[model samples]
Target chain A: MREYIYMDNAATTPVKDEVLEEMMPFFKEKYGNPSSIYSLGQTSKVAVEKAREQVAKSIAAKKEEIYFTAGGSESDNWAIKGIAYKNKKKGNHIITSKIEHHAVLHTCEYLEKDGFEVTYLNVDKDGIVDLEELKNSIKDTTILITIMTANNEIGTIEPIKEIGEIAKSKGIIFHTDAVQAMGNIKIDVNDMNIDLLSMSAHKVYGPKGIGALYVRKGIKLDSLITGGGQERNKRAGTENVPAIVGMGKAIELAYENLEEHNNKLISLRDNLIKKIEDSIDEIKLNGHRTKRLPGNVNFSFKYIEGESLLLSLDMVGIAGSSGSACTSGSLDPSHVLLGIGLDHEIAHGSLRLSLGDFNNEEEINYVVEELKKIVQKLRMMSPLYDKLEGEK
Target chain B: MYSKTVMEHFTNPRNVGEIENADGIGEVGNVKCGDIMRMYLKIEDNTIKDVKFKTFGCGSAIASSSMATELIKGKTIDEAMNLTNKAVADALDGLPPIKMHCSVLAEQAIKAALLDYSKKNNIHIEGLEDINFDDDLHDHDIEE
Candidate 1:
């Protein structure tokens, strides 16, 4: 087998051994429905509650407020739709930024078709939501303010506390899609004044199917999946005991070694970024210099398409991602890149390399060396680059 | 989502770079659509002597351009003009359905260069008049 190097952790992460070990008993030895009236079922129930408490403690929320769901998309859907429908009598307006994941943006778009007003506030060139614009877009009819804690594409961290404060002062419910931020950044519901937050286990090295939504106490959201008494009569489904257990262990491990983990990733990320910048000319970094995720490195090479760059990288056994239209399977490239004021051509050339705990300095060095050669080769075949050479 | 043949061509595309002071030059697609292909040709005695291309697009687009240049390198103008987008795709083993438009762009690029060659010498090439280069073939329409 070829030597492989993975740098696409933002897309998904491998389940850790520790998390898997904690979940093994639930899958076979402790297999029972949490709602059944038996000793075996009771064991499952206790395991589920323990996971809830671990999730809540990680974000400083009440254990009862952490309701398990399918994944981040389901958590986001339930949060926005539940809040919007439950508070429809109060208002029909919803506010969100343009850089949110499709879970938030698409839900808002769907709400608009149902007669609800939505304001997609623009972001700055660094992908930060404008605080003044968010404040001005609010109205008496505004019922929810949903923004992402961090962008998935560019990795720019948003001003969540400020946005939460604005929502609090106006008595509007605030929700943040923190799927990309849950384990990477610290969260305190009360300290940030956040009413609701969405998280996924897979992004934090847990199982893929299980996630949690933090609904502050007394925030009565309409039940999204209504069929059973599960999730305290909110989200209804059989508990995924193994996945829930895995998530608990994963979140605990992430927070336990948060400082060390972040320090390693940040150094590797910055080293790679600096090396690329020094080696390549006419390349633009896509996110904020420092106020971005510790693991993200996004850049747009001036005259080459991202899919070609990604393919070239893959040829060398490196896994990366791109914001190019060809990779997106659509005519337009990443909306997040366009939201940050990049032209279509520039957006089509964007590449994202997200470091993780499994990556090391040796892998980073290998990627940098291979990337320089790939970019040079691709640029040589590009007509746009040919024009630049001709002019020179 | 590419075929093995496509990956091979993309990794080491044939006939890359521009032919300076060529008899014909043609460029198609735009930056907005995320693909631009430029083809240069060297013709002698009514035959294509040399052909090269420069492309800014995806793997399939680059591969299509590479294959198209190789197909027409030593063929007569009429033989090159007879090449179809389907032929180019077949030459590459088959592109993904969404990427078939890259083959279309390849076929158009070759004819476009032939038209440029015809216009420069003021010689009439049969069937070149019916080809409307302005019919912007969008990718969405070809995607299945």
Candidate 2:
């Protein structure tokens, strides 16, 4: 069997062995409901609190402020809908960026159907939302401003601190979908002035189906899933004990080696970029060169389609994405790519390679070499390339 | 999603180069819409002796072109004209619903080549006259 190089970490990561080990006893040996009043249940309840503290410390958030949920989508829905409905009298308008994950975009679209207005802030060519445009779009009736900390496709880090300050000074609620940025970047809720944030365990080398929504103190809202008054009656569901334990351990490990992991990822990412650029022609780099995530390298090769390139890479055991993994099967090019002012052809030709902890220099070098060959072969077969030659 | 046959054609495509000074040539789709296919044909006494294709698109588009070329290589002009997108898709075991358009490119490219053949020979080919080469060929069935 060929060795697989998994470079689509922005989509999801493999669960750490240590995190899985920590979660093992919870499944069989410590199978008890946290809602139960027995001593067995107390063990589960204490485990839940400990995981909450672990999650809290990772983001510099208080344990009381964190509410466990299913994952990023739920956190996004709850944060947007909860705030919108709760403050409907105050304002019916919400602000978000065009490059946000569909978790936030679709939720905002749903809100638009029910008389709530939403303004989709556009990003610059580098995928950075204009702070001046954001300020001008904000109206007295704007109740919430939910921008992402970093983009999933191009990996452009948004100006979250400035956006947070703008919302805070205006006394409007601020929320961030930090699902992609959580493990890759350092985030302090207090320093960033973020009112609410969303994060998922699966993106941080933890198990799926476990995530948290950070709701700052004294900010009350309607509950999304009303049940047995769990999660302080804010979110109600039976806790996923094993997954939660895995998340806690995973995040604890992620932050412990954050700097070292980032350094390695940045080096691999930059080396990949330099090698590819040096070897290939008619290729344009997507996203901001310096402001992008350490692990991200997105590029658009002329005269080729991304899906074809992705399939070619897959044959060589390299896993990557054209844009967002969620929207890959769709015929339309990524909205995020288009939002950054790329033409439809350029957008369709885009590729995103996101690295993680397991990637090394050897794999990066192999990928760059394989990619050069694929691009050359595909270009030869491309009608557009023929046209370019004919024009020349 | 692609079938086994589609993957086979995509991996080792047949008739993938251009025929030099071909009798007729047809190109359809565009880079702007993400799939561009150029078809070359060599017709001898109403029979397609040679057919080749060059495509810039997804895996399905390349596979469709390869399969389409193989289907029409030895067929008469009339028989090649009867070829449909459905037949191309069926030959590939079947493509995903969204990727059904790639097969359409195959059908269109063949029709386009026949149209070019008719124009160059000045012989009015039936059914080839109706093909509108200017229309946007990429009609994606995107749900709102």
Candidate 3:
């Protein structure tokens, strides 16, 4: 068994055994391009449809609504930019939140240069986009409202249903990047009024390089990729049969265990939070205490830095993300942290440990112990820590 | 992962405090961007009597700040002013390429505070006005 402790579930999850099993045959003698006319090709096509059905069933959507893309970024780009271009005659304004993943933000930014106006709403300290703010931001020209269902950085969930409802009343479309929440949380696109939704396979324990966007049946969007007809002419190019197959299997498995998994995850996460909070001083939790995801525990220590904390934990065989992978090299803190009102020092000290199928009490305990030591040692050396101590 | 030296300096940072009624104090960085360094100096008779810094940054950031204070303390104003970011990185065994900027920021911040002190004492800090602190602050801007 692999002894490494993997806490970076939010970044990407390990492929589940069953998902891999479902994907295996697609790579071998059973392999065929889904677009071809031969029998082997037909087999792959049927598999793709079945996978599509499996995905649709999970979210209570029709099979034709799900369009597979390269990943969350591609799906996000397609959704925001695709919809923006296709709906240009309807309106040229879009509403979204400040804490949105760069996928949405960058796409919106790209649209701005093309004559689309975007309103970026601010979130509260816990990272929830306010309903009033959403309503106010909507205008007659507003065509879409894109907000994440759950934050990738702080794990704070926005009120997607309320925001979706508001958008619907105004005759505007609402899209959610549910990449982190899909498998972990039960989402009813119909109930939430999520007209367009996005999910990544890797985030749900499937494979990387495969993701899907849920475009409501009547919604119009220009195809982001122009190529051979595939995905009902919405998405083009060769389908990732193996990865899509794995995604279907993974989604099925995730839904089957969603409740139980969340229960386990919530307990573990809460326990981990408690253990660390009790052990360390000057520690502050970043996300909403209750509205946050079940598996994520994000916190900040006053005197310690996140990279130092991460590397210290890495030394003992633990892996996790500081924040969004997009902003990894930049010295600036995670924008989500800043949006939630954390200044640079504390934000730089932010650490997120997202639990998953692998983490258990023993591992949590080990992390706690190791973390306590690391924080203490790092704080001892921190010039800021010294000053804080001096002030005390 | 980081080197043992980085981990060491990060784990035992030096000059962690604020100077009161001091000769000079300089603060730089938008902490909202994740790295902030405030350098404090106490100079008497043209010799740096005490040097301290409080930095909120990554391992290399804390290490560089610690190294900066350690390098400048007990030195004359000229010697402290002559310190380079390279010296700080070298003292910490060597910072990662991405993190070298942290040391560079620390060096500029140290020089910034010294420049302020020179202005307060009416001494022309050699190359103080000639060197652009704001331009050196380019790396600190959070573009993403």
For residues A216-253, could you state the per-residue lDDT of candidate 2 as single tens digits? 99887789999887788888888999998898888889
lDDT of 1 by residue, B1-144 (tens): 889989999998999988889999998888988999999999999999999999999999999999999899899998998998889999999988889989999989988999999999999999899988777776456642
Candidate 1 vs candidate 3, lDDT winner:
1
- Count of backbone clashes, every candidate in sequence: 0, 0, 4
Higher-DockQ candidate among 2 and 3? 2
True contacts kept of 1: 0.90
The numbered model that scores best in lDDT is 1
**Cand. 2: chain B TM-score:** 0.95
**A1-392 per-residue lDDT for model 1 (tens digits):** 55799999999999999999999999889999999999999999999999998999999999999999999999999999999999999999999989899999999999999989999999999999999999999999999999999888999999999999999999999999999998899988999999999999998899998899999999989988999999999989899999999999899888888899899989999999999999888999998988899899999998999999999999899999999999999899999999999999899999999989999999988888998999899899999998889799
Evaluated on the second chain alone, the candidates' TM-scores are: 0.96, 0.95, 0.90
Instruction: List residue ranges in candidate 2 displaced over 4 A.
Output: A324-327, B133-144
Model 3 regions lying over 4 Å from their true place: A323-327, B1-33, B36-55, B65-81, B90-97, B109-144
Alpha-carbon lDDT, every model: 0.93, 0.90, 0.85
Q: What is the DockQ of candidate 2?
A: 0.59
Worst 10 residues of 3 chain A by lDDT: A323-332
Flag regions of model 1 displaced more than 4 Å.
none
